[model samples]
Target chain A: MITKNRKITFILSLISAIIGIMFAIQLKSNMNPVPNESRSIAELRSSLQKELEKHKGLLADISKYNLLFYQYESSLNEGDSVSVMKEELARAKRMAGMVGLEGEGTVVRIQDAVIPEPPPLSDLEEHSYIPNAVIDEDLRWLSNILFANGAKAISINGHRIIATTAIRNVGEDIQIDTKTIRPPYEIKALGDPDVLISGLKLEGAEENLKLAGKQLIIEKHDKLLIPAYTDARVIRFMKPVKTKGES
Target chain B: MANRKFYLYLTLVTISTGFLIAASIESTKARNTERQNEKQFQQETQLNERILAEKKENHQLEVQLLELQRKVSQVEEALAQRQSEAAEILSELEAARMMAGVVPVSGPGVIVTMQDSEQAAASADVTKYIVHEQDVRLMVNELRAAGAEAISINGQRLVSNSEIRCVGPTIIVNGVKSAAPFVITAIGDPATMVGGLHLPGGVMNMLQDYVKIDIQEKEHVEIPAYVGDGKMDSSAS
Candidate 1:
């Protein structure tokens, strides 16, 4: 009779434990219905658009400084000090893509490939299907290829390719820095045109582009003009490290 | 005696049952109250919306700040024009040049020469033995932290936006091609820069196992100015 009673106590404890676990789960769900699902798709889209507009205004302001710096430079007279400054500024501007570059190189333009839409109610049709787009990763690889193959300066749709420049996708748009550029990406490189053209063909670049559903158009320009970066960021946070014994 | 023990067990069980029932009843009541508070749930959603809106407003203010700074520069230009302070302008321009890394610089610092390990050639995976762009970037960062006035890898000077990246087997510095045995030159106080590079678990120690690293303290190291197109033609735009 004692053994039967002990078994009944064990069964009761197991049933109570299961009930407690279910209660805890229900409490957790009540606290957090869905994590990070607060913002709707429409809200995110508008926020990104607002950010792009603000960036444009900032760029316009920086261009004014660029104009003043030039005027000051031209005002200086012919002297050792003045000449050195001019030479240095000119060199710095060229490297920083503040100046236009014209050289014999290749221009690669990539566009999204057109694919036929599947029939309605077909098994192949997917509800979450994303259309073919020339992604940032594709452009990054293409630019890296050109840079590696002796391209001195490069510009994509007037945006100068620089070290700090980031290629990122916001929703569906490909953003370089703050500029959102559309399809038919034009990449102009300033280097040996023959070498640049040949380099793209190397390492199955065409095959990779095809797999990504992109069409490539390569043209060798004797004088391809690549524009400078209009917006130069002012370094406010990073000051030069001061050495010892300096005021 | 057996009857007394049974009665004690029965009393304990009855108390536990009463406690469990009371706790369960309280939990259900609390849950019902939470479900009824629709205002709290709406506030949470509204709070998230406010955060995104605030971010947009912040960017708008930044744009206004940039515009004001641009106007201030315009005023400065006008004032300078009236004063005709050529000497002052020339000095400012000179300082700009130095910061721009367009002129050759020389100072006391350390030279780091890194080469692929000889045994790496025989290893199945040779990638581990070769020096990478990150390795160069780490050394450059350490030197800068130690108050390096100037830095260069091979002949390529490290600039503000300069990228040191690897493409295939070669590492590219400032758009210049480079192979193994990268000789990095830094201009700063000889003692401090050396200490920064050779610190415990520093870049030198970390890369020593994969690549042969040699450090030399020099009285003077000259870094040549960038020879590429350094001038911008603003008129073209």
Candidate 2:
């Protein structure tokens, strides 16, 4: 026969097991709500639009400056000169080799920059951003020289560098799915040859390029004419930061 | 003694069964409560997840909207830029046209001849130093600046609405084919316009800057009437 005390212990144990199971079920049900990740994405988009509008206005102003310059130039009679003078256009349109005499200006070449392997601590959590600080400094250095030398505009491949445009750090070996460009970058600049060349040399860009495993070449000739892009982009939208965990 | 033991055993058996039943009842209630609570919690969690997903989707749409807004804004900017530039050029042309006193004969304006340098064409890779689009834009800009009342290429008219574009080495004037010694004509003060283009650092300078480029500015230059339909279609937006 079972003892009274033993029987009571068995009953208590069975009840305890059932209660434990119920507690477990409650815990599982609690895990349903995760809202922060998705909401953050929406918030980001609203902010970026406001930023783009501001920059767009600035670009419009710069274009106005160019238009005013254009209008003022057409009124000159034969043999008249404008504020900006061209040494070559003064004569018949010059062809290659005709203007091939060695000029004293800088030479610009464009190429690709290789991406280094990421560090061990790059657990994908710290947010690996493009090296904006370093890239901006290099670009700023280039800009200072071009500005000092009176460059009206500069083109990389066919892309024009306008007054309001910026040289952004796209990524290492991936700019809009194209290979990342770095050294020996080919840049076509419009301005006074004497002024532009001297300006590039002023900021010690040559030495800086050497240190950074890159190069800068600026070629100045009356024959250096680049076509204007028919479809120039006025602005691009900024992306919002990704939400954590839920994404 | 046997009877007493049997009675004791029966009482014990009854108490144990009653306790077991009570425990079973409590367990059943607790399990039902737990399951209901779990279902409620799951529904709440699912709702939360849905809300989060919706929020994320909304955010993505917003970003796309922002991008579209940026693109449209840029288009508007380009349109304004072209208009102002064209206007300025038109005003200059009008003034030059008044000074030159040329009448509308239902024909294009004075034609200025642009050609590859007669001497430079013999060189290797002649195109390397050919006239560039910018050069044309500069010259055209100067023409407008100089008051070109009406302008055209070959036979196309230069209205407040017209385009002068270059394709590779060839020039595109109002969808018409043209090449070196691009025949650009302007109506207005023919003499004044020619003089204005010849101005140092004007269209002449821009053209000269190109490879093997030559520009001929003339007055009273009779430009042919547009033969081909100058169908002007522009997507300003």
Candidate 3:
């Protein structure tokens, strides 16, 4: 009986030791703190901000080169041959709308005409919701008129209206060379302000402008800044036929 | 009495041994699972490091590109400043040809072809079925809006003062009269130009209502310059 008691006590002591070791390990693991979620998120945000700053720096460098190139091209040179070349270059630049010109010009602002609410009268029934509001054709007509009246350079909303520049409606937006501009459209013509203003008064122009349901605001500015064309002018598809002894 | 005491001790010994075996097995399984978690954590950390390295490399390459661009600009400026009379004249002549749309240019662009609907002959209003000058004008307008560097309609280069007007059954583009189907070749970024035309309710949608229009993105497109008379007379003062 004494031997049996000794055996049972030994087994009980062994089991208790095993239980104690397991509990100790679990307690140690639980005591360690969990990772801080907020800290990790803050780290991620900081990295993203750093990346964006780097990207901006690169873009600024590119623009700096662009400005320098423009300045170099516009600088005048000496000598007879160089002068003639310069003159031709200047002419080409103007014709291509690559140079910004400032002159006494007229600014025509065209905005959507606000239709008044119907007064609930029988005569006013047809007047509600007048759908005409400064469509693409109005601007085209005005631009054509300006050109015909000897406007040297014309720009609409900073987009130099060159021969290749097209004013078209893309889903309620007027896009000029991948740039979408909104009303009120400011059309600037670099010419005699008086002449341009008078040109707008030509036959069928004023009538056409009024019928388009646009609020027309015309004024004269002594110095209007028309921006240069900032897109590629590379030509392909039609080569100049070689004249006699041209090569 | 002695036998009963022996049996009780034996039962206690067996129960304790069972408890020891169970605890060891549970601990080993927990350790194996924890090892897998650690392996996953290490892989995640390696991926993060790779991402950081790649980003740093990208930044370095971008800086190099910027530096090279500045160098090119500087060189160009110097060259322009020191160019001889003949060189300047030649360059200006080339520039003139480019602006006049008389020089061939090759670049990435999109090609658009418009064909009259074959089924339109049976329809009452065949005018709407055929590609009109208005349709060509709208397409060219959209292409220009999409930043097309150069554009041509059925091999006629559109330069300054080029007109697209309908004369009876045919369309006159740049004084070169052509009937449907008009092929418009433009040189620019293929994707942006195509995207601009294909935008919902855009030029493609509007033109597709009348004629069958097909657009394709080409990696390289060649546009011939204006082959007509080089009339620089339209220079507006």
Candidate 4:
């Protein structure tokens, strides 16, 4: 008994209501953080990124077993094999954090954006050396050093260490991620400093810093706390590398 | 006549029922297929990622192993080169130890300085001009072309994985801001690293034409620690 227009309206309304219900259910699953694709660099910037969360999860899972053995490691069994293994594991984790391999490494600040510096005329003496572009050269060298040192996570300043972190001189200052970090910027490496430092030296990266009157420091810290990753888990979703048949 | 009408009504009902069932079946099948496709894609991607990661780890091990073998072979190479084996081991250790990142070794290298001068407004005395991102890019490309084995800017270490970006009027290196005077360091054989710039239209001459950025060579140089994120994903390898 319904007219054509009335029937169309009813069907449309039904579809809308069903869609609304589906969206409402989805919203309930994830509260607070709106999801977006996570680039590795964003997570690396925060001190408590998702990688840190993962490490904590790992620690929690391992601690369940560790607690049973901790009781066993009392008075008589001070140097038990299990205890020794635990200690070794701790050392490895510390080393990993130092060079940014396993856990997040301590932040070794490199530079900050204070006002600007006035240059002296005497600095431009005849035959004085000068650099051309900064971003490209510096980034290439840093990447070379990191790979050599076995760093798994590195943050220039506040930027998270993602797979896409770039080092380029945009205009006035050297740009890292999207922020401008002036000197002396701290570089937080999540791996062993010794290995990282040595690797940089082998590639001759250290040589350049010295000639330029730059401050270079390598420290071995116990841990680096990173923030939880709040971005989307999947990346580049629309463009499927595989074809429909393959998928 | 009554039987004929009854038959016609039964046929209509049968047709409508068949159409509805067919539509429902098609929709269900499509949903299942979509789900199956998604699952297969994820599995394949994961497998590819695992294989790539293993290869990268294997490559690192291989490079380290090669360096070790080079040191051991130094027993012969040192004698042939007429260098002291003790000194040769020291040099080789210094090089190989770097990849392993065990020690900081000093070496000859190059230093590049950049300054950005804001364009003069109404009342400012100026010496030249501001530094641009392209200037930095040119210098980096020049250094690489000159065969500089390593480089860093504002303590952001350059590796095979490092990236630099240009934002507005500033330069970002490994997510760090390094304004003028921007210093770029390159490590390599001092003679070659420095000499490489002497060629025509290289970084040095270009600097002279541009902001007249400075370039210096040091017999002993020490590059700073890298401060970029080194997150390793399974697919990045």
- Which stretches in model 4 have alpha-carbon errors above 4 Å? A1-247, B1-105, B117-128, B227-229, B233-237
Ranking by DockQ: 3, 1, 4, 2
For every candidate, C-alpha RMSD to the true structure in Å: 25.1, 24.4, 24.4, 23.8
Q: Estimate the overall C-alpha local distance difference test score of candidate 3.
A: 0.66
Candidate 2 docking band: incorrect
For candidate 1, give the DockQ.
0.03
**lDDT, candidate 2, A145-189, per-residue tens:** 554454434555545432222243344431211224454345665
Best by lDDT: 3
TM-score of chain B of each: 0.58, 0.42, 0.59, 0.49
Off by over 4 Å in 1: A1-84, A114-132, A237-247, B1-170, B175-237
Q: What number of backbone clashes does candidate 4 have, counting pairs of residues 3 or more apart or in separate chains?
A: 114
Judging by lDDT, tell me the better candidate of 1 and 4: 1
True contacts kept of 1: 0.04
TM-score against truth, every candidate: 0.42, 0.26, 0.51, 0.31
Q: Summarize candidate 3's per-residue lDDT along B87-113 as a digit string, tens digits.
A: 665555555646656445666788899
lDDT of 4 by residue, B1-237 (tens): 874565455545544454455555655875787686666556555555654565454445434333433333343234325534334443333333232222222356788887753342322654345566656656765665555545676655554344455555555665445455778776666567567667665666766643646778887555532321223322121
Q: What does the TM-score come to for chain B in model 1? A: 0.58
Q: Which stretches of candidate 2 lie over 4 Å from their true place?
A: A1-247, B1-110, B119-128, B209-237
How do the residues B74-170 of candidate 2 rate in per-residue lDDT, one tens digit apiece? 4333433556644343333322222212112222234565656544576687764566554554455555545554455655443321335566657
* Candidate 4 chain A: worst-modelled 10 consecutive residues by lDDT: A238-247
Write one digit per residue (lDDT tens) for candidate 1, span A31-79. 6654445555454455455444434433543454455456545555444
Among the numbered candidates, top DockQ falls to: 3
Interface RMSD of 3: 19.3
